[model samples]
Target: MSESSESTIESGGIGLSEDALRTLKLVADDEPIPDDDPGLRDLRALHAVVPNTHRPGHWILLDPQQTAHNLLWRGIEEVTGILDRLTHVPKITEALTVEHERGRWRDGVGSEYIEHADQINARLDQIMASATEELLTAQPRKRSKSLLTMALPRDSALLERGCKMRTLYPYSARVGVHEPKWMREMAKRGAAVRTLSIPFPRMIIVDRRHAFIEDLVFDSSPPHSGWYVTDRPVVEWMSMIFDLYWTRADPWSEPLDQAGRLTNPIQRSILRELVAGLDQKQIANRLQISEKTLSNHLTDLRTKLRFKTTYQVVHWWATAAENSSALELRDGEPFPNFPGTEGP
Candidate 1:
């Protein structure tokens, strides 16, 4: 080869350094190269130059083309083997996953405790992505607008796949600027969203086969972890709980009006919580509203009903519970009209 071509090979066109190319050339021409020559190291490493058994201290150069061909052939074989293994990876993984899932099923231990919020979100994405039949969620706490915005694309994708999605939120969520609009947008996309006046636990059920719920410690104290559950009985029970709440919740699109009642949904929820013997702070927490907001709602209720004090409000609530037949009566639907309870 010409010097330039030899230089190219030396510079890694073929991984043969310039000195190694020189050693090769000398060997090819039947010229003896010194054992300690600088170029001999590269030639020896490549195995292109070998010891001459008949003449000690002498080296032989194999045909370069054949040597190149051999290297190329070996490389091709190695890469083909890697490709073949890569092709089978999915099958092997799938088989192992099947066995793993079955073992968990048989052992009645199909739950994973995830501690971090980010990890929980990631697992939720995976669960939702795999959902083909239905998605159900109950959120007892209010969500930030940013969180709702982040979930829009994923929820939209689920709806687009023709999967049924149902979500339940506290009635206090309707007081937000973003939540009602987000709920309506999702409802328009064929998702069923409802607001409940009563308290419920946070849950996410996919296909009625898998679920995620809050994790509690051995002492029944919350550790801020999540349990990803696939246990059949547990998941089924959770699904039923969701269905029970869902049936009683008011649809997102409908205004909370029951025959032109005076109290709205939030006020009714506050009244119910008060009737349940919850203090202002506890009522606010359960209804997913601030204490000030809860107090404001109570003040509005008092003004509307022409009551003078909180005691009178609760007293009337108790009396109405017994005598008001046309009223909400259950699950905190908007209160129906009483004979003299009309307000502007």
Candidate 2:
């Protein structure tokens, strides 16, 4: 048979055609095997059975009894074939495809390529356009004019869409009249406001689907200018971080205690630090306790007075002290008696 035909037959599996068998017989006949030739009897036996089975390989010829043994080998080959196709080839192809796609997308559309402020703004606008249900924000004590300018308009638009809004601020914001006024207005129009002494991470989650976190380098900058936007995995990570602080934060329903009425040593310690404007970490260090433990005590105090922000706590303490002083002045003897002794 031709070499091309032989290659085609080998590609399928080793099988003897009539022409190939005729050629094999002629070759075996011409190669005369003497009676003393090693394994001459075995060769003659193999040639006898070569035309009987479909596979004309030596295994069937030399050991026809081991034909059943080929079943075990065939089973192994079948299993190897399946594993190569399913587990090896397809998995490698999928991984390579994913990596190639990721490289192309990142190289072409990644945030690192955005150089201008307008490019960043445009990206955020695209995100905002798709937001559906809710938006949660945490802003720092100090606000920038540009952020406020952009945020106020965006906040208004979100409110009009009936999105639920929640904002967290530092207690120091109470010193700014404008912040409280803004909070009150936002609260009046379906937003909730809360305050904590702890500093909050700058974050925004839209509809629980997309979240934007301030990049480490841009933590102190405007978020729209430098932030990462992603889905669940990143958002859930930021949400956990927020909950770590939120659990320690005082509830908004608590009324402010202005008076220094917190007399317990731990409560008083926390109160003194608050009055001194020391942060929670400093208070924890001074008292030789963990910040988490200090926060627990503060939370206990908040529950007692029904106050939220540390500012409200201090404000309540001051109000109580003023009331006590006014009562003391009322109890003092009238000064008029000294000037009008002749009235008797």
Q: Give the top-scoring candidate (lDDT).
A: 1
Which ranges of candidate 2 are over 4 A from the true structure? 1-121, 217-225, 250-254, 258-344
CA-lDDT, candidates in order: 0.77, 0.56
Weakest 10 consecutive residues of candidate 1 by summed lDDT: 321-330
* Residue 205, candidate 2: alpha-carbon lDDT: 69
Residue range 1-344, candidate 1, lDDT tens digits: 44644564445445776677677778777776778776776776565788787877678888879788877886688789999999999989877776665455435567876656778889889988988999998988878788899889999999999999999988887877788888888988999888887788999999999898886632322355677899898898788777767766778778787665667767777877787788999988877888998888889878988988998988887766423433433455544344466897
TM-score, cand. 1: 0.60
Query: Could you tell me how far off, in angstroms, the CA of residue 185 lies in candidate 1 after the best superposition?
Result: 2.4
Give candidate 1's error at residue 299 in angstroms: 2.0
Cα lDDT of model 2 by residue, 63-85, tens digit: 54564466457657978998778
Alpha-carbon lDDT of model 1: 0.77
Error of 2 at 320 (Å): 21
